[model samples]
Every structure is written in C-alpha cells, then in structure tokens.
Target: MSKHEILIVDDEPANLQKLKRTFLTDYTVHEAKTGDEALLILKERPVVAIVTDQRMPGMSGVNLLRQAREVRPDSIRIILTGFTEVEYLMDAINQGQVHRYITKPWEPVALKEALRQEIERWQLRKENERLSEELRLANEQLEKENFRLRQEIESLEPAGKQLVYESQEMRELMRLIDRVVPTNSTVLIQGETGTGKELLARYVHDQSPRADQPFIPVNCGAIPSELIESAFFGHKKGSFTGAIENRKGHFELAHQGTLYLDEIGEAPLDLQVKLLRVLQDAEIMPVGAQVAKKVDVRIIASTNRVLSREVEAGRFRQDLFFRLNVFAVFVPPLRTRRDDIVALSRYFLDRCRRRLNKPIPSFDPQTLALLRGFDWPGNVRELENEVERMVILSEPDQPIPASMVSERVRLASSTGGSDAGGLKEKVAEFERSLILEALRRHGHNRSHAADALGISRQTIIAKLKQYQLDDETAEG
Candidate 1:
C-alpha cells in the first residue's frame, strides 16, 4: 500500500510539532505554520488528511479545511479549536467539512483514535472506487471479446447466423468461446437442445489452427449402443459379421482436425472409458485390431445433459469429465439471445428463398411481432425450420399475415410478466414491427426491404424465413 500523507496547518510552531510527532510513526506528516503555507504544500503533494488550527492570521482552520476539500474531496478533515462557540462549530462543520473536532488540551489517545478512523474511512473509499473501476474495465473487455466471437460465428455464414442480441451473459460466454478456440483444449459445451451448441463447436473448429482439416461431427445419441466402438474406432475387413471391408473410424478421418462428439453424455459407461483413453493417449484401438494407432485429432465435445450430475450418478466417468472440461462453454438458449433474433430470422428467410429459387415475400407487422414473441425451445434450428416453412407457404409478392403465426408467439407483444420473459417478448415484438415497417417502406420488395433495414438482400430473406413469412402460395 502507498503511504498516506497528512497535512497539519497551525500558526503555533509548538502545536504543529506536537501533532506531527503523534502521527509521524504511522503516517507521513507535513507541518505548516499557517493555513496559506499548508495550502501551498497541499498543491504540491497528494494529502490524504488535513488537520488545521481554527484561529489563524489570514485564513481560519475552517476556511483551510474547505479549501482542502476542493483540492482533494476524499481527504479527511479535522478541526482544532479553543472556542466552544456553537456557531463557530456549525460554520466549521458546514463550510470546512470537518470529519472530527479536537478541543484544546485534547487526550492523546482520543486524538490518535479519531485520526486513525478518518484514515481508515479515506482508504475504504479509495479502495471501493478502485474496485468499481476494475469491474467496469472487466465488463468492457468481456463485451469486446464477445463481439469478436460473434463476428467469428457470423463469418461461418451458417444457415441461421443473422440474429441480433444484446445479452451481457451471452456476450461473456461468446468471449469464453473465443479464448478457448485457438488451443487444442477439450471443450464441453452445455445447453438445452437447439441452443446452437453445435454451431458454437463448429465455430471453435473453424477458428482453430486445424481449420484446414475436416470437421467430423458425430451424434453420440444417434449411433446404436452396440456399434459405438466400431463406429468411433473403425473396423477391419471381416472384423465382424457386417464388416464387408476395412472402414476407417471417425477418429482416423478427423486426424489433425476436430471431432465434434455431440450428445456425449449419452455414451455408455464402457464407451466412455474407451473415449477417455483416446483423449488421454491421442491414440485409438480399432475393432478386431491389436495395435493402437496414434492420431492427431482435437476433441470438441457437446451435450445438453448436466455432466456433473451424470458423474455423481456414476453414469459418466469423473476422470473423463475432467479431461474434457479443460475449457467449458455454455451456449445460451434462444430466449437468452433475443437481441440476435431479428437478424437471424432475416438471414434464414433469405437462405430459404435462394434455395427454393423463389422471390422473397414481405412480413406483415403482426406476423413479425408474433415471431419475436415466440419461445423458441428448439433454438436456432427450430427458428430455421419455422422460417423455411413460412417461405414455402407464402407467395413471392405477398406479405405474410400475423394470423399465420401461433398465438403463443403473438403473446410476446402483450404487456407485463416476468422481467426476463417480458423483455424477450417486447424485443421480439419490436423486431417484428421493425421488419414489417421496413417491408412496407420498400413496397414488399425484399431487395429494397433489405436496403431499408440497412442490411443485405440476403439478410432480408433469412429474416423472412426466421419469421416464417415465406411467399410460396401467395398471389403473384
């Protein structure tokens, strides 16, 4: 800790010496014979506390304390006075802002205690301000990191990556994702189904050093329990009754690349042990083969299940859990990233139009509002599907009606509820309205609508799909 400086201003040389001696051991004491001299010293140095005599030639102790407050508002002030006048004390308290008043013939211990307490208060205030500054800086850094991560995710130009969201928590998580992406660390991504866990995993792989290599995705839950090992480790020709020829496992194919093991919590306990061995040794033993083959594969595992609970229940190996948890990233569900919903919706709509080779349709105000209000349990994937459905159903020149959207989604525009729920619903409603207004301004032309929204034509189509406002069946 830096030394605390105390300024003492008194006309009498003896009194200045006495007070200086009392605090010299615990603090750095600067003594002055007059208030003007003390002010000069204060201007030159950083003083944490000030002690002044009430009676002086040019300036009183109260006036000096008030001046000290202007220079250092946080500085502790003490007044030393012989007068017992109530008016003087009141003026000292009001103008000089004295923290404590010391009468003539003061007790040494009492004076020391008062000085110590004043010093403590000053230190505490400084410390709190410092901590607050640090927290603000930390939050800013986290937001930048999240922004970079989101950009990286958008660079993928995935099917549904056009949503706009303003969640601090999600931004922090995105920053964590960026930090862990460059290394070959095993990442465990957790979230509910459709929460874009796979998108996050893919982002990690794409941004990693092994971006040039293949990204092999495996759904652990999709594979049969009996064929788990053979599927992961490969099988030699005639190794088993169905093994017609030698086939390489996902591990071999993913050499020097990323293997996204989705739904890893569903893997059987026996397979978990094998998976652990592969992760630890960087080698795999193929089915019906005695030798273990070394491979350079980066593991990016994801699961919606709570693995800690699984470990506690003996369903997942604790050792394996630790190995895969070198970096843990949680993808927030759609409800958490509402800021990105409109952007994502527009992106999906555009993609659907491109794929269907049809002109993109416009979204009605009510329809856009309903899309935002819906609770997307299925996440980005669900949103994409909904958008595609709408695009195929609506006509090229027609605007999608709000009546087509489910009532549950429409309720998002309603007033009052839980803070999280209400905010999400309101944002959704706002997004819907914005999109419709843009479409109306552009005369239902997707290209013009995109321009009006200050986004690309492709982005508008994606948005249309995300809101489920396709133009397939509308009157052209």
Candidate 2:
C-alpha cells in the first residue's frame, strides 16, 4: 500500500521528534513548527492523520484541527494537550471531530494503538464507499441489457415463422424477431408440427451477432434418451456404447454460435435437469466425464406443447420452463390468418411452378373463394403442399380450379354460411374465427398462420389478445 502522510504541529522541536519516532514506521512524518505551518502542509499534501499541540504561537491546535476538517473530512485528528489546556481538549472534540486525545508524556504503546484503530476505521469507510459505487454501476448495466434484450425480442416477432402468410400478422412477427436477434438472451419458439419452428429459429440465429458461427439444430425428441447426453455434452472416446472416437457435443459445436433445441418439451425429465444446469452455469459435463467444459452458446429452444402446463403437471422442470420462457415467440396457424390465404397461395403457386419448370398460372375467382373459406388445420405447411400438388396437376396455361383444393376444405368454405352480416362485424367475426381455427389446426402455429396472411404477425397477435384465445387453443 502507499504511505499515508501525518502532520505534527508543535512549536517544540523535541515534541515533533517524539511524534515522528512513534509513527515513522506506519506513516510519512511531516513536522510543522506552528499551527499556520501545519495548515500550509495540509493544503499541499493529502494527510491521513493530524497530531497537534494545544499551545502554539499564532494559532492553537484545536483551531488547526477545525480548519483541517473542511479540507479532509476523513482525516483522523489527535490533540496533544497538557493539563492546563483541558478546555482546548473539549473544544477539539466538539469542533474538529477529534478521533483521539493524547496528554503530555503519553505512553508510546497507547498512542500507537489509538492511531492504528483510527486508520483502520478510515480504510473501512473508503472500502464501503468503493463497493457501493461498484454495485450501483453493475445494476445500471443490467437494466440496460434487459431493455436491449426486450427490444431485440420484439424485433424478431415480425419475421418469425411468417414465410407462409401474406397477411399483416407476418409483418408484425418479422418486426419483433428483428428487434430481438441482436441480443444474447435465449429464445423460445412454440408452434405445432410443420409450423416451421426450426425455420424461424434459424432465421433468428442468422440475424444475430453470432451469425458467422455455427447454427446447430438439435431435435431433442428425435434423439434417444440413452444418447442424449453424448449428443448435447459430447463424449470421450470409449466412454459409451458407440464411442470409438471422441465427439464434440452440440454445446461445444455451437460455441460462439447458436444451439437450436427443437421439441424441447419432449426432453426426458433427467435430461431436462442436465439442460437446466448447463443453461444456468454455461458449462457442461459430458456423459462419464470427470470435469465440466465451458462453452459460450446461445440457446434457442422450441416446442409444440404448453410448457407452463407441463411444468405444473410435473412433466417438465419449473425452473427450466421459466428460464426458457424468458423470451417466447408463438407461431400462429394457417386458418387464423385467412386474409393472407389468397396472397400466400399465389406466392406458393408461383414458387412451385418455377421449381417444376412450368409456366406460372393464375387461380380462378372460385378457387380464391374456395381457399378463403377453408379452415386449414395443417397451417402453412399444409398450404404449401396443397399448392405444390395443384401446380403439378394443372396445365401450364390453365387457371387453377376450386375443385383442385381438398374436398373437405372446399365443402367447408362453400357451404359454411351466408356473408350478409355488416362488413366490420363480419370482418371481426372472421378474424376471431380464423385465429381460433388456426390455433386448433397445426397446433396453434401463430407465426405460421400470420405468415400465411399478408399482414404483420403482430396484427394476428393482437387479434389473439382481443379474442382472449388461450395458448392451448390458439396454438393447438
């Protein structure tokens, strides 16, 4: 540590020498012959402690200590007063906040002990202040990071699972996803089969800062329980049944990149515990491994099941559910975003034609009407398949017919009901019905349905909110 300066004010030379010998080992001694000289030394240097004689020529020791208080509130003050200067001792206590009072011919050990205690108190106060400042800075940084993460999550909403829709809902989802892709927070995507949850996860990873690194997608449900650990945390050679060679786990492979765990809800309870530990600690221990390996991987988990319900039912870990739910992107189904059905159908139709090396064809008005009427349970995935089928069957220059759509979808659209209600009321009802139906179909792929429509994904999201559709129904 650096040396502390101690100012000694006394007109007598012998007294100054005595004070110097006492504290010379612990502090640098500055001798001031008078109170005025003591004040001058204090002005030029940072003194940690002050020792002064009561009787001085121009100024008294008490007055000097009082003035020093204004310059350095933290400095320890000591008054060396004789029996005759009892009044000065009282004055020093009240005015200078004197830390300790010493009398003439004081014992050497006692004087040293008093100075040591005061110095220790001063050091403790400084340390406490330093810690408080550090804590304040840390909290401020955390708040900023949280806000930025929220914004990034919001931006990703627009682009998420919206490739199938032509509605405003698709736009909204895209916007939210865009905002969230820049941060380091984990993302949770919830959608049904064929809703393109993996596709959206890839989109997020592609748009993130870690885009240049690997984007490893793992189907948690597809992996066998016995091999899950090896797949996730890697295994040493000869450690497992198939361990002819060492293998890097998903976490290691995705270092400085993203690890997309699809169907996370289906992970076994035992594996869930291991996954939680990795997320919490950023380190993983491979199967039969003695030590944990550190990895820097961004996790993006997806599921078609209701995780909260799964947690409540004891099928999934509550802590793990909360951790993954930090940021959720729900993909809507196809039927809910009916407004984009026509547009999406046309886009898919054109795409299919190009892929098949066939001329682009238009859909007849009846075919458009038939598509709008169908309640798509399979969401965008179903829609794309249907379009591909139509492209293959239809002639190069022929317009697609209403009969080309599945008989069930065609019957529902054509014979559902009359369209005589007021436009606003009818539109509102249509939106509500679509949202609910999409949620039921494709297991509520909000992102998929939103994309199928030509609108922003947020719009379909708002409808879900306005309609008060539960996740089970909206996503089912």
* Distance from true location, Cα of 9 in model 2, Å: 60
lDDT of each: 0.78, 0.78
The best candidate in terms of TM-score: 1
Clashes counted in candidate 2 amount to 64
User: What does the lDDT come to for candidate 2?
Assistant: 0.78
Lowest summed lDDT window (length 10), candidate 1:
157-166
**Cα RMSD of predicted structure 1:** 26.0
Top lDDT model:
2
Tens-place lDDT digits, model 1, residues 1-476: 66788888888888888888888888888999887888899889898888888889998888888888887888898888885754677766765488888888777678889999888887788899999999867964664455455646656544434324456767788788888888888889999998778777877887799876767889987888789889999988888899997777889777777899999999888889989999889999989898999999999899999999999998999999999888887888887767666667777767887778777655654565566666788887888787888888877856666665655555644543666456445556576667677677666777766766556677667767887875453221
lDDT of 2 by residue, 6-30 (tens): 8888899988898889889988989
* Candidate 2 local Cα displacement, residue 360, angstroms: 3.4
Backbone clashes for every candidate come to: 31, 64
